[model samples]
Target: MKKGTSPALEVIVATHKMYVMPDDSLYQPLLVGSDFFLNQQKGVTLPKNLILDNTGAHISSKNHNYSELTGLYWLWQNTVKKDTNPDSFYGLVHYRRFLSAKNKKTPLTKTELQNLINLKYEIILPKKRNYYIENLYSHYAHTLHIGPLARTREIIKEKYPNFLPEFDRLKTRRSAHMFNIFIFKKPLFEEYCEFLFGILFALESSLTKEELTRYDGFHARFFGRISELLLDVFLYTKFPDLDKRSDVLELQVLELEPVNWIEKISNFLLAKFFGKKYKKSC
Candidate 1:
């Protein structure tokens, strides 16, 4: 827990782009509810989700299709449609938005900018892989140019008045993006095993171009410290929920299993060092 000896577990930053099932119908409301509460209590609760990290930026729901163009909007607008297919509308609208962004020369609105910055998961465009890479690298470099944490938080809160967990997660995951939903997304812990699985997902192997260079010089240093790094993360996970005994036990089990192997190696090394010390003392 020393200041300088903190674990330097580097996250290789990359985009998590993937084609999602147009499950926008199911997820949209949940997203709304979460955002609403997050914004309503914005001044009181720390807006941890507002921080943009590897998962991407938090998209404002204002310009988002679900609220503006879908049956959900109609429902809110008091124009109920009997055959208004939620799924169909979401897919069509999403496509329209995509094409609009691609073909149009218009400047991106605040909402569009937020989605591009945060909501769009990083995925490699197989055909235009180089372009994707270049664009993402540029984004990573310039992400913080326009705003700092407080300003960024305010901007997103203005968008998703109902839910802001994704934004909250960006803050938590800025330090570590390898973690999937557990770090930033809502965690689903069924039992100890599931909890352990959540932690594992938080571990990622993203390395930016610049980070790769540092690895070359410190291969030995990095390898030597990985065990300690993992252990430290396991320990650090307890905070913000230290009283959760079940979670604490799961973490201990997770750490101890690996610690057994680490302990044996350390014991051998200590024996050798002590023998050498005694010989020198003698």
Candidate 2:
């Protein structure tokens, strides 16, 4: 609990499929859709190294709609809330994405993370993903439905009106701390989870069953995408001087898989210039 002390930090890597992970105690590989696999795919064996998100308190059944957030919900209820150690730190990262070092290729080591913690940083986040050609709102509108985002603003107005200002500012920004990746000290972690799920649950209730299920498997996971934007809204509202804050650390992110830049750029251009919505993941 004291400053400079090496506190326990656990970063859960939310994964639905098997993939190689970093060789470090700081990272835990969690199978997000464990419940579905167990119930729906009878007699199937799972990896022993991975933790199942379906255990204890969980929303594992909603993995289809919530994506990696199911693993986050599991961590919130079963780990963060239950742990007796108040100084413990927690984080969420995707199986293929990770917080990286200066070289931007190596995964951050525990010693490096501890050094940051010792420096009194309460939060660690991935570097911003910039869409130089378009703002966040326009990018989402071009690629995904704007209805959910519009309704999210309405929900913020009704429930947390003060956040409306920051939420509206997202329209003017081209870069964002995306992928819903972050590491937080216990207090901030709990506060963030409460604020985040509160808005998401309200948004979920606002949509009808048909509206939620109408999208293809890829697009149906709008809940996760929506939360990506909400992260900024929550941080900005809670910490107005976030950019200047010494307590927050933004590290580079490493992508395990090779990206097809040409295809991704083509899809973005097609979505923005043409009327074609993204049909598949790049």
Candidate 3:
């Protein structure tokens, strides 16, 4: 591709120069430098003009910004177990699947779970406002062996002889109760939940009266910083042209919060009007 001729294609090509085809074809690899590309067939027909204009609907600069911000936040929050709560984390996934799939006896109830789901999505689905507390442990584990947590847990024991076997043993069970035992040795689990609590208040959502009463300084700092980051991303994306010079920076700050809100409302309405459209052909 000619330099700077196609700004959209050029941007991707520049970032992924090493990942481009050796042929003279104009194609650039998607998910460049990642294992996802390494697994692909080499002789596949790589098309020129493979990338679309960033100005188009799905390919717009705004959507690109939104997806990137959401992804970064997703990475940040995925590290914290409580943030990845099926109730907190995957509520949208379950809600969509259960309502639109063969399963009818879904554990989630709109009446009972809506408040909880709303609170979580508001806080977590934005540019992930919280850091994963377990990243250090995950980093330690991954450094030993590249596999799932259970396998990595075993590797940790063999590699770090001084590491406690009890901690490894607890990690294997994958229980919340198991986590509580070794959690203090790793920082930020309590801090993670405390951040959630502050968000709950900001959203003006109902919480357990006890959650409302608890007070902690570390919790305040953790949440305050995250909330500010989330709000900055939200404001920047929604009004990027507010400062034209650095629209790219503002774009980078975008998140999927607006789209998430639309989807949540749409799903709620779909569930209500369509009588939960499950068993339909995909």
Q: Candidate 1's residue-wise lDDT over 37-140, tens digit each? A: 34555555332222112112222232121121222222222211222322111111121122123434432232432343254322111011122222322322
Error of 3 at 64 (Å): 16
- Report lDDT (CA) for all predictions: 0.24, 0.88, 0.27
Q: Looking at model 1, which ten-residue stretch has the lowest summed lDDT? A: 248-257
Error of 3 at 281 (Å): 21
Candidate maximizing TM-score: 2
lDDT of 2 by residue, 34-127 (tens): 8776777678776777888888888888898899999999988987777766688899999888998777578887788888888998889999
List CA RMSD, all candidates: 23.6, 2.7, 22.0
Model 2 misplaced regions, further than 4 Å: 1-6, 39-41
TM-score of each: 0.17, 0.94, 0.18
Residue 48 of model 1, lDDT score? 28
- Model 2 superposed RMSD (Cα): 2.7
Residues 121-147 of candidate 3 have per-residue lDDT tens digits of: 222111122223333233223222122
Better of 1 and 3 by lDDT: 3
List the candidate numbers ranked by TM-score, top first.
2, 3, 1
